[model samples]
Target chain A: MIVAEQKPIDEIKKMVAPYQKLLILGCGTCVKTCFAGGEDEVAVLASALRLSFKKDGKKIEIEEKTIERQCENEFIQEAASCVARNQAVLSLGCGAGVQDIARQFAKVPVLPGLNTTFIGVQERPGLFTEECVGCGNCELALYGGICPITRCSKKLLNGPCGGSQNGICEVDPSVECAWQLIIDRLKTLGQLDNIRAYIPPKDWRSSNSGGPRKLVREDHII
Target chain B: MKTSPSNLQKTLENGKFAVTAECGPPRGANVKVVRQKAELLKGVVDAVNVTDNQTAIVRMSSIAASAHLVQMGLEPVMQMVVRDRNRIALQSDILGAWSLGIKNILCLSGDHQTFGSQPDAMNVFDIDSMNLLRMVKNMRDNGKDMSGFELNEAPQMFIGAAANPFADPFEYRVIRLAKKIEAGADFIQTQCIYNMKRFKEWIRLSREEGLTEKVYILAGVTPLKSAGMAKFMNNRVAGMDVPEDVIKRMEGVPKEKAVAEGLKICLETIAELREIKGISGVHIMAIEWEEKVAEIVKAAGLQK
Candidate 1:
């Protein structure tokens, strides 16, 4: 899931302050699951913003609305009426969603209320750890399903650097060393030899290094 | 046997137990600091390793510092970390460093940025240490860059890599060393050794795998300044294992006597390291304490 956290209410307030009529847009999919931008969150944020603005003796109107997903045009249309009525949209969506809304409603200003962190899964409630970097090329099979490119602090492919101590990364004691996990998992799968093979220098051209990537699916286009 | 223009390599090749010391560049652009450190290390060690922003803290460029060492009639093993530079900058610096008469290069995946003064800095680990080693090897041996572009003159660097016998997944450490050797490392400098038992085990495994014959292995030794430093490293420093007995030994001494005890412990470790079959040399990392290096070397009877 796309994990993100809400920007501070102060920053959000400053962003929406110029507009008298504002819409607190919520994304119901990834951000919703992470509780950053959801129906309940949007309502709470709306109430908070109202109280904050009222305290300052400023008269501002806010409307809260959430759709199934902000990425797709169909779901985005659900909030079209609310978006048109407001001067600007305080998008409680990921960066991509904010851009998507901005692209659709070219005139309305779409401000990002949440900071899109990473493409990750919730390790536990309120705990989200990054698992993938979308490097475009995946070598999970060789690493026992562990992604060193994403998890390892150094993005080391050959093996763990000297920093891996007692299954913990030297970069952060809390973060488990990715190479340790790979070695253990490979040992469990009886594929320990996989690690012995030298992984050559990664081709960064496939990753974001090449530039913003695009995938075209002719079969799904029709 | 002279594969590169590295005096360190020649010394090791001539069946001599080489001695190398680390010299970190100053935090600011101060040539005097580097020269002062160089003066202390001059003639005491075979080659001085100029660290590239070690601990991820900003420092004077290693290349510039290494060039300074070259001017001072000292051989330098310019450490290159993959954390800061991409393939382009790394290759460019290799050529530039070699041009500046720097012969030896230590390839490393540098300390993470979070541990440094600039925690907010973005890191560029475009290549790992292994890849950096391979890249340098290719540039030196094949006379080709990473993109297969032929170079005007190959940077004939005596490639070096680091090893940590104390790091976890203990069994695979030897395998990693083998991989480093295969990747084109002519020599290996290990992380600081306080755990003799584990270091011996790692050496035994390396010997069994015959990795010792493939690459020169330099045992790393750092004189613990005090019991507090020992405890701090044991708990905080990554991949550093200071045994409880060693810490107790340091604590047993009075605060004023701790420095002498630390030197004694270092000398004892050097003696033990000398007896090890696969151990080729000792790389002393005095940290900010470069003055003690010559004294330690002379006291260990390594001063030629």
Candidate 2:
């Protein structure tokens, strides 16, 4: 799931100030679940902007269309036909939705209505926390099921840093030590001795921190 | 023609047995959905109230829907919720609705963000529902805004609010209603009522406590169509209490008979509400069940 947060109303208002015919698109997927760009928020924001535009003696046609999902091309098309007349689309979806809409519309400017935060799950109803990062490689088997790239304070692969104390990382004591989890999982499987094996240093050259990343599968692409 | 304030006052004074119905706007831009509901209930009910985003789902604007209702020759009561809007937007919408000659209004704070498909939403209860009531009254009476600042023309509206019983303590609910009444609420449309015994008792108590004379009260009713609907009302809706006997009746009957039973129960409740001395009206909430409303009213022995 893509975690997202609502941009403050003022910030979004400024973002779409130049557009007269505004089309507020609501996504029913991630942004809706996160309460950022859902059906309700889109209506509220539209009403607010409508009144604001009215007070300025400006007649702006701010329409609302809530698609079931904004990430997919098919669902985004549900909003496309009606949006051509509008000057800009104020997307109440995730960052992916804004980009996807922009890709589809091409001519019309698509502004984000929510700040994409993370990819996470519903820990419980009404609450969501950071979960997966979707890093290019998966090393979960070597360190239990818990992802070190997303959860660890230090993305240690070879060994646990010497600074760990009480199963907490030294960088932030509140964060659990990823190495400790790996150790526990290993002990459970009677493979604690694997820690003695020398592992190569992680190459950061291919990671997102260097620059943009792309994936291409020969089987899927012609 | 614009009716004089005194004429409105006199009409409202003798407005006993007033019947109201609700129409929710469509989620899409097409006005047909709302217009269809308004036209179906028009002339049959005294006033038609348009709801703003019930259940926090996206919909067309209630004000625009009210405009359509007004065009259809129905007295439109525009519902405004402050939960989404700041004071500026709320005040402007009220004035705009009034300028459009749509006078009656229902001021609601609306559903919280947590209840909707959306969570983590920012609730600007900057001004609660009561304060909006005071603001509207102050704007018209004192010719000033909420901050005592002057405006060129203040909108005069027939103010109304909602009351929920059977959720919290009944006395507290009554007290809350009394507070809204004290804050210049001219009328009240209550939450859904399925049991007349509890409703009549509440009305009797309110009359005893001097609530009946101060403001008009309209009991809200919505028919429970199926056993699933009854279950949803009982569990999902916080204040609405659909009685087990009614559910049992619906369950035991055939599918066709069950709808008739539901309509019959609603008519009985409405007839009972009409007989209550202090009750002024009934607000029928036949949401998607608009077609069954006329039948229900006729069965209730009310003039349409």
Candidate 3:
């Protein structure tokens, strides 16, 4: 899913002011399911911009496009046919989708209408919270089923920070302590002793910390 | 329709006894039904509300129909749902109504489409109704949107939000109503009420919990047309409670007298609410029974 967040409407309005013709692009993947940058959002944003401009007595043309998937280059072509005389493209997709579109047409400015939020899953209806960070390393086997990278403030590889009071994160009190979650999961799995074993320090260099990460597979290669 | 700005304030200061009415849009595009109902209460009602998909069922747009009410010399409170649109659409409709010079707006989270015509329709609840109210107030008061960003010029409108009187336990419902008032609601139009004693007790808690000074509380009175329909509301609609006594009253009345008896019950409820401290007005949700709205208001002896 293309994870995304929404920016302030005025900021977006200011960014698209000069361009009378614009495309409001929406992604139908992750952000769509999360109710962030979706087809309905694209229509609404387009309509809002139309109204905002009308309030100032300035009229503009807004074209809406909903691509099947925006994070991939293969799906980026869906927007190419619609980018005519449009000086600015308001991408309602996630960061990856925006980057893919921007890179394809380097001359035109691709502005994100959404703020990319996080890698996560929908726990229930009308709610979503971060649950994972793709560190190119699988460490859940060591820490139960919880991801320390995203949930834990320090990404503590070996232990919890001393500031975890009442089993809540010190960084943001709303966040559940990662170690606390790991301990709860272990208790559920009847393996609380797993926390007593020796755990190796996480090498930050091997994860997202060092640089932009990539992958290549021979079986998927054409 | 003729209440001057000063007169409205004087009424509020004198606290003029008021009666509000609800007129739901038809389940389809047929305007004849709603138009006929509007004609029935063209003069005797305070305001005719245009509900936007009351049960989340698709109908003629509320704004267009409310515009019709305004043309018919009735003040139309346009009901908007945050569950159907994002902050973007919510603001757009608000501005659209403002540009048309429509001032009174009723903000709602709306019935989730799961409870409406299409259960599988994708619901866009990126914003709640409270945030929607804040957005409208932002345009007028802070000259900003829901995100604390500036607007070109704010729309000055009287904003209203919903509260469920019979939804949760008495204390929880009162606390939530208090919270809604604190969020800058000019007035509150609540869910249906059958037991005025329970409603009176709920209003009593509002007094004990300090909710009166903030805003006006408009008690909702939905006049029942049939006992079967009353049972349908209590069973299917979440947060709606029609007491068994009201059901028995509905069953005891003959087909011809049921509607009149229902109107009497609503008038009595409104009169009872007026006795309680801090109860401001009555929002009559007569539904398809909009013809009886005038009768109820007249029977309750509310303001013209």
Candidate 4:
């Protein structure tokens, strides 16, 4: 799922400063699971902002709302009334969700409250690490399910760039060397020869290099 | 079949022990220092390597510096790394370097950006060193650009890549070198050698695989300035191996004569490397001590 983290409270406060009435809009799907822009997060931010404004002797009206999902038009329509009453919205959603809400509600100024990080998997209960870069071309089969493009700091297709030490990357000791992981996994799978096969330079057009990508299923289209 | 001949290429092809040196362009547009460094190595060395934003520190472009070296009648081995430019910039620069009469290029995946002054800067490793070598080779062999467009005139360049014998998973280093050679690397310049025992092991592995016969391998050697510098490189520099004995040799010396002792160590290493069967030559990297390069090269009997 997409993972994101909330911006600093000071930055969020500044973004909401000009508006007399603000809506803290949250998404209930991916962002919710990541704890960035969820219903509970929205309430906490709303209460914090109310107290901050109160101490400053400002009478700013704060409203909170959480939609099932911010990316879908059907779910976005559910927040129309709350959005109509607010002067601006502090979108507690991923970048896609914020952009979607802004696209639907053209008049209201939508400010992003969360910094959308990456497409990641939860490594532990509270730790999420990026697992995919959505390069549009998947080559996980070659690397024993390890995504070198995303996990490797250098994005080296033919790597472990002389800095892999005891499975730790030279860039950071905390980060595991992606190539080391791939070699280890491959050894376990009896495909160690895969490392010997020279993977040529990747054709990057499938990724973001070609610009914004979209998909259409003609058969399923209404 | 060679369209153009580079002195270093000719030297290696002739089976002579080649000698190359590095010249760092000034952080600002001070071409005087660049010229001085090149001048110091003028006839003593076969070619001078102009580093490209080495250590991610913003410096004058290696291309421009190499151009200046060309004007000085010196062979400039322009070093291009993947840290700064995407494929477009890289290909464009290769053509530009060729137009300026630069015949050699060393492809490397440069140091990470965090070590530089601009730590927050975004790095664009659009291609790694291996791919860069292949792309350059493609341009030369196919007479076409990376985009598959035909070129009216393609650059004939002597390609080079980097290797580190001291880095971890030590057995795999030779395989990586083989991969780079297969990817069209014409020459290989290793990282600075301090742990000769470990480096010998790597060289032996390369010999067993017959990699040395395929590509010219120039061992990288840096004359240490002081014991402090030796410790810093061992502890702080990634993938560098500075054995305790080498550090002790420097630390054992008095502070006043440490630099001279350092040069002696480099000379001994060169003498030893020449005796190795697969070793082709030496690339002396006297960082910040470019003035000492001529003395070391002459002492090593490379000044012909």
At residue B226, candidate 3 shows an lDDT of 78
Displacement of the residue A58 alpha carbon in candidate 1, Å: 1.7
Misplaced by over 4 Å in model 4 are: B1-3
lDDT tens readout by residue for model 2, B151-251: 78778788888876554344335556776787668988888887666677778788888999898888999987887788788756645677888778779
Q: List where candidate 2 sits over 4 angstroms from the true fold.
A: A1-222, B1-11
Which lDDT tens digits does candidate 1 get at residues A1-222? 999999999999889999999999999999999999999899999999999999999999999999988899999999999999999999989999999999999999999999999999999877999999999899999999999999999999999999899899998889999999999999999999997877788888888899998889999997
Clashes of 4: 0
lDDT of 1 by residue, B15-52 (tens): 89999999999999989999999999999999999999
B1-304 in candidate 3: lDDT tens per residue? 2223222223444677656687777777787867887898777766667888876688888887887777677677789886577667788788787666566788776665656668788765555555566667778788787657787767776778787766533434564565456555788887788977677788887888778767777788888777888888876565567788988989898988887787777777777778878977778887777767777777777648
Residues B1-304 of candidate 4 have per-residue lDDT tens digits of 3466899899999999999999999999988988888878888889999999998899999999999999999999999999889999999999999999999999998888987899999988778888898999999989899889998889999999999988867777888999999988999898999999999999999999999889999999999999999999988888888999999999999999999889889999999999998999999999977888889988888886
DockQ of 2: 0.01
Clashing pairs in 2: none
Give the Å error, residue A52, model 2: 51
Window of ten residues with lowest summed lDDT in model 1 chain B: B1-10
Ranking by DockQ: 1, 4, 3, 2
Is candidate 2 or 4 superior in TM-score?
4
Give the CA lDDT, 0 to 100, for residue A92 in model 4.
Answer: 93
Candidate number achieving the greatest TM-score relative to the actual structure? 1
TM-score to true structure, per model: 0.98, 0.57, 0.57, 0.96
